[model samples]
Structure formats: C-alpha cells, structure tokens
Target: MDSQPPSTPPSQKHGQTGNHSRSHLTPEEQRRIEVNRLKAKAIREQREAEEAKRIPHPSPTRGTNIGTGVKRSFASMSSPQGPATLRDGRTGAIHTNRPLDSIRPARNFAKYVEYDFSKMTDTKGGFLTEDDDPYNKALYVRDGKKEQKPAHMTQKEWDRHQLLKSTRRDDIMVSGSKQNTCCECGSLEIDRKWEEAFGCCVCSSCKEKYPEKYSLLTKTEAKEDYLLTDPELKDEELLPRLEKPNPHKATWNNMMLFLRYQVEEYAFSAKKWGSPEALDAEFVKRESEKKRRREAKFRSKLQDLKKRTRVEAYRRNRNGPAGGNFGDDLGSGSRHVHQWGRAQENPEIGMDIKKCVDCGMEVEELEF
Candidate 1:
C-alpha cells in the first residue's frame, strides 16, 4: 500500500498569516491573549519595585567611609531613614529621605529636668535616726533649682506629700492609759503596771500569761592577744586565769564565755565615775519628792470634800428638808429601801427585767 499526504486546510494552502495554525480565528480570543500578557508584565514590574524599597542601606558604624579617615557615626537602628525604618510622627508614613540628625531631636519630644542631690543626706545603709529627718528630705527641682509654687493641696493630701520626711526604723509608742483592753483575756481591766512585768511592753491580764522563749546568739569572737596580755593573769597562769576558759562553766556556757572575754578585752573606762552611794542618794531624793506629791494630792482631795459638805449644809439651812412647793408632791422623806422591799414582795410588780418560772431565764430590756 502507498502512504497518503496529510490533509491541509485551505487557510494554510493560501498562506494566511493571521490564522497560520488554524483554518479560522475569533477577534475576542486575540484580544484576551494580549490583555493577559500585559497584566503579567505589570505584576513583575511591581514586585521588583517593592523589593528595591525593602533593601536596607548600610550604616556608618559597621564600616568606615573610604573617602574619610575618621570613624563613621551610626544612628539608632530603631530610628527612621536607617536600616530599620520607622513611621513618621505627623503623617505616620514610612520615612527614608531625611538624615538621622533631623529626625532624632524631634523624636524625643519629652523635656527632662535635672534633679539637685546636694542636699540629700547619706543613708549609710542603716535605720535613719530622728536627727536625720531634716537632712534626708529632698525637694523637687526643675533646672537644678526648686520648682516654683507648683500647686496647692488639701491639708490631708499635703501631709502625705512626696517630700514629707520619715525615718527608716520602726517606732513603737506604747500608750498605757489609752490601752483599755487586755490582749490576752480581751477584758477591759488593763492597767499601766502590766507592761513593767515583761522587758518588752505587753497587755495586762490575770487569766493567762504570755508564753515566750529567748535564744542567745554570739555576735562577736574573742582574740588570743588580749587574753594573753592581761595584767590579772598570764598565758601560763593557774586556775581562773584570763587565758583559760572555765572548764565547769564553759561546758554549757560557750556564749557567756565569749561575751566575758570580749568585754574584758575591749572594755574602755569612762573619765567620770559615779559610785553606788551616789545612785542611792539620788533614788532617796526621788522617793521623798514622790511622797510629798502624794501628801499634797490627798490634802487637795480633802479640801474638795469639805467644800462640797459646806455647800450642802448651806442649801439645807436656806430651804426645808424637801425644799418648798415641789417637796409636797414628792411625798414623805422616807428612804427608797422601804419601797424596794415592798416592790420585791408584790407579785404584780411589773419590771423591765422579770424572773421567769419555767426556764429560769430573766427577761432583760433590749435596746432597739
């Protein structure tokens, strides 16, 4: 069998260039193809432009400029017109045109005033004493000086002002008279003498006593040089010597031995010394003065009583027993004891408080 020639459309046979592959064409398809090609080109150009904008510029500090011998100055990485771009303050748009010098000063809008620390007292890392109140306090300053009459505040608020002074240590003021209730018993029978019993202040109560415990701590150690150089004893001395610790007492009294040694080693004597007799004389004087004051107080109270008695006698002499017209309405001058006995005996006597027969409960008058 012989091969046959492929079938060719009439458009190809006649060399029609517009529809070179096909025998026929539509106008809409040609237009759509051209539009698609144009869109692809536009998208590629836009992506390239965005990539150029994303690329960062080199800063001065990382490398030196070839032209200049001096070190390169670098702007803040967070600032605008640098490798890290920032939004404009006013417009909120990405900034890149201006240098850092132009944008930095404007970026820091706040004005900070310097404070004066010359008057500030040194704390020395301890509880501040009462004398440090004036020195430790500070005032607000703008440009190394005090701020002019800033603002007026209420008395309560002014008392709590920031410049108000305070001590670092805790102050405990125990007012005995103001303390009415005992902390232990919750009874209103507290007295001034309760705090004297304990070394530390505490509330008064007879029902129970507060249970407390104490521990002795060694805050310092004794040195060998002082003990050996003592005049009372030598290093190679006998019993009760400064160099040797008490064998019997030292077994359970390590802290006491250390304290005794420390005090004896470093103890300094005062220039002026007062004897025991002097202290006794002063105490006797105080006692005598206290006794005189008590006698004076008693005499004053007696005088007050005498004056009251005289006034009562004068009133009784001026008017009769019950005192004029009002006396008749008030009845006889018999004592209230007699009426109280009759009222208790009377079965129909009504009272605010009554004895109950059943539960033996007394009915008490209750306030609204």
Candidate 2:
C-alpha cells in the first residue's frame, strides 16, 4: 500500500472538530508573545541584580545571557507577580515593593486644602497665630516637586534651640591601682587581670604578669625561681615611675609562647596532623633514645662496681681469719703461694678466698 501524508487535524483544516487538534498561529500573536517574554526577562534581570548587590559579597562580573535567563525564570516562578504583570500587561492591585504601585494610591488621594486656619490662635512657641491663613502658607504638597530646605543658624540660635543642644561633658576620674613591685628584680606594677588577658610584660624595672595559660609557672604563690613575689606598692608612694608599656606586648609574647608549646606538645596529642607533629615526634623519640642509653650505661657501671665490691669483701674475709695468708710465706723458694697444699713443706702458699675449701668457708688459699 502506498504511504499517504499524515492527515491534518479536522480542527486545523477548515475549522472542524478534529481527531488531531493542531492549530495555526498568526505572525502578530507570535511577535507579541516574544516581545512580552523579552520584557519579562529584562525585569527579572533587574530584580536579581538588585538582590545580588544587596548581598555582602556580590560577584563582580556581569552574568552571562544563559545565567541571566535562568535567574530570571527562577525569580519569576518564585515571585508573587502574575504572568500578565511580568508580560507588561495592566497589573491587578497586588501588594508589591515596587515604588510606582505602592505609591499610586497615595498619589490619587485628595489633598486637604479647604479647611480654615484663621480662627487658630497662637499656641506655645509661636507655632500658630489667629491671623495666620493656612492656604496662603504655600507649603509644598506631596504631589508637588520636593523643595530643598535651607541650613542657616546663628551661634545664638543654635545655642537657644533645645533640639540642637550640645552634649554634656563628663568628668570621669579613673583611679590608678597599686601594682606589685620587686625591688631586687627591678620589676614593678603588674596587673594580674591585664596579664591574664593580654600577656606578661617583663620590663627590666617591672615584671608584668604573664597569661595564666601560657605562664611557665602554675597557679599558686609566686616563688623566686618561676616568679617574684613583691610587696604591693601604694599609689601614693614616690617610687620610680616606669613608662607605660604597650598592653599588647604581653599578649603577643604569650601567644608566641603558646604556639611554641603547642608545637612541642603536639607529639603527645594524637589529633594534630602535618609536618609540625612529625618533626616533634622524631625529636622526642631521639631524646628518649638518649635517655635510655644514659640509663643503661649508668646501670652497667653500677653492676661492675657492685661485682668488684663483692670480690674485694670475699678476699678480705678469707684473709682475715686466724693464720690467714695472702698466698706465700716470706721465705718461699717457689714464686707460687700454696697456703693449703704445700704450707707444711713450702710454707709459702696463702689462702685463696675465691675457691671453696673443705671447711665450707671461701679460701683464697688455705690458712697456714
């Protein structure tokens, strides 16, 4: 069978109700639709740009056409404006932030003008008088162009005006505090609270307190080695006045010390990462190895010294007994001393305490 062109919808072909309801559009409608879409897109772009600028950190670059299209579409879908309003059609009386729409009603409001003011008597501060005519005052109405106000006031006028009064000056006296001073160390006037917050100020004449966290000393009475405890100086005393040092000096010093301690202690804390921990761990390991070596050497030397002592004591005990001999008699012919075996014949041998003899006592040799 021969293939035929797909049948056009009856509705589309000659305005009949159809199986396929494809409809044709006029060029005018299509152009109108495109124009409306473009206008809507522009408005949406303006709103997005405004919102972006209001943010803390707006992107410096202008958005691409594609980005603008996306932003516009999203903004329109989310906003309360209707499609007709977006397409530049006459919008309904919808509440909005747009200035024109918000102020339109106010612009249409009838202004009050026919009221009489001549009957009004003078109130306090000369605000009004009975002879004054309200309409003749010529004050600008809301509908009229805004007029610039003049700024001119004499010194007396400003002084007389209660609204323009100068601020009252306050005379606040801050009493100086008595600081701790160490005459021997030449340290003076250290505030503990300030030191805890900022850092220690170590002046040659005065030692300011260091931060509690970063201090080398623990919390307790200050000692000579870690800290100097001095009598508190009275404010009235005429002692040497030291120059006021920067408060941040102690703070910075403590911070640096803290950083150093962190680096040193990071080896023990398992949470730290990177090269800081790695370097410190290696250093600690080496130090531990050195300590172990030193301890081992000390123990080895101690053992040797103990063994020598034991040997000397044994020799002394064996020789100190009755008839105890070192090994040989004074007139021995042989060089060897035989106190136990040949003492009767040779009479030169001395007791050997290192060996066990039949008597159960240690013998360097046998006693003569």
Candidate 3:
C-alpha cells in the first residue's frame, strides 16, 4: 500500500464518483434549505386541507368506490330500518346480493310452467283451492295443447300455430256482464245511445245534463281541440269509441265518436298534452307558425304581382306609349318617348342637360 497507489481507471479519471466528496453547505445555508423545505411542506399540507374541505368526505353510503359522491341506491339496505327486499315493478324481480341467474320467482306462477293441455287449468291442482267445473267456468278459457297441431301441417304453418297458441290466457278477462243500473243518476231508465253504442250504463237525462263530460267528440275534434294523438284515439282498448257512417260523404271512412270526458282525461294525462297549459302553448305555437306561413305566402304573391306589373309597364313602354306619337325622336320613325328627368346645369357649356328617366337619353338646351 505504501509502495504505490493503484492507478485510477480511464473511466474513473474525472470527479469523485459514488456520492463521495459531496459539497458541504454552511450552517446558514443548510438552515435556509431546511426552513424552505419545511415551508413548502406546510404550504402543500394547507392546500390539501383546503381541497379536502371543498369536497365532501368519502362516505361508505356514498358508493362502494371512493371519491365519487353519487348516492348509492342500494345504500339504504345497509341501514337498520331498510326494507327486507327490493322489488322491481316491471320485471317483478326481487333485488338481492346474489347473481342474476341465481334469482328466481318467489312463487310458482302457472304462466311460466309447462303446459298440461288435457285439463282446463295450467297447474296440476289448478290456481283455485276449489277447481270449478269446465262447463261452469265464470269466464271463457282456452289453453290449446302443444301437440295439437293439425295433420299435414308444414313446418312454417306449425311454427305459426305454436306462436299464436303460446299466448297466456290464465288471467285474461274474455267476457263479463254488468249491472243494468245507470252509472250516473242511478235511474232504471237508461239511454239506448250509452247502452247500444258505447255499452255504458248511463241515462239519457245525465247525457244531456252533463254535456261537457258525456257529450260525444268526433275524431277531428279530439285531435285538433284536445290535441290527442292518433295512437291514443285509434286504440279501441285505450279509449272506446262509437263508429258511424260519415255524414258528409257516404264513400268516406266511418267517423269515430269518443266520449268527451275520456278524450279530455287522455289529453290532459301524462301521455299526450300533459296539461291544459301545455295544450294552450302548443296551440299558440301552431297559430304563430300558420301566421308566419301566411305572411310568407302573401309576400311571395306580392312579389309576383310586382314583377307582373313591372313587366307590363315595360311592354307598354317598348310597344310605344298608348295613344302617343307625340314624343317620337326626330328622323327616327321609332316610337320612343322621353320621360325627361330634372335638368342639371352644364356650367362649362352654359346650358342645361336633361336625361330620360326610363331610356337614359340625354339632351342639352340653352336656358336663362
């Protein structure tokens, strides 16, 4: 070691390596750096605190995920007073912690079960505790067998038959009879109009008395006045109507007559116009559009009229002014009239220059 220090490698020829021989700071400089670092750290912490204050604290009820503040719908179940289970209105599904495939109907619904067509009822024991005899059924029931397709039927025809036969009629109301008593005044005497036409139990006195509610509404009146849509008025199930031959034309389609109250109810409901105010707004908008179209039409007609008048005036002037050879230019034999414009001074020539208003012909004349 004392004899000779090992020669440094060429790669290690420059400054000290491996963090050795570092620059040493003075106490003041080190203090300043430490102070600045502490100040920066404090500022950063303060900013973080402010940011935390600005946003709501992460809550378990907010969502399973952190940061986002969206209130979870399922969060209520975690509470003490939540419902035992959540039920879906449309799907009739009971919400649970399990997977979708694992979920099932609470009770065995006959509609979902396989068909047993030898019997009138769907289920083995029937839905009722006491199975009523088929002949004495309160309502008409039909549940055709799966294997009941007619002989020599093609695959297409068989498939179509199966499709039509698959309709579930377990809970359907096919036909029923109602009481003969009047729905309005309870009078034994009811109108033939209500009973025969609309199949409603309403007396003739009530029909005339409550004109606003019981009165008939034509298809045109329902659409234009009440702002009802085609689907709403056309659907017999939705709004029952009476049909009659068109009074205006026999060849035309039959007129549909809807009850005034039914039309009004549908019109003001959430489905159509929503409210009276909304209907009024729609009417105003339509009227304004109609007025704008009318004005535009009038403007177009006026422009055409103006163009026609201008063309006629041009033709009259070109063919020579009516009843006039009076203003013909000298030595030309052409019938051209000079409707002269106001005279302007020609200062250099000490004369007045006049130009034709229509033809742009100019003439000079000495004037005092």
Which candidate leads in TM-score? 3
Candidate 2, residues 126-202: lDDT per residue as tens digits? Answer: 55442465445353344546422323435565455423222111111223244433333535443433333233433
Point out where model 2 deviates above 4 Å.
1-276, 279-283, 310-368
- How close is every model to the real structure, measured as TM-score? 0.22, 0.17, 0.37
Minimum summed lDDT over a 10-residue window in model 2 is located at: 232-241
| Model 2 vs truth, CA RMSD | 30.3
- Candidate 1 residue 183 Cα shift, in angstroms, is 42
Worst 10 residues of 1 by lDDT: 336-345
Most accurate candidate by lDDT: 3
Clashing pairs in 1: none
lDDT of 3 by residue, 81-123 (tens): 3332444445544442444765666665633645345654555
The list of candidate 3 runs beyond 4 A from truth reads 1-180, 188-199, 248-251, 319-368
Overall lDDT per candidate, in order of appearance? 0.42, 0.42, 0.67
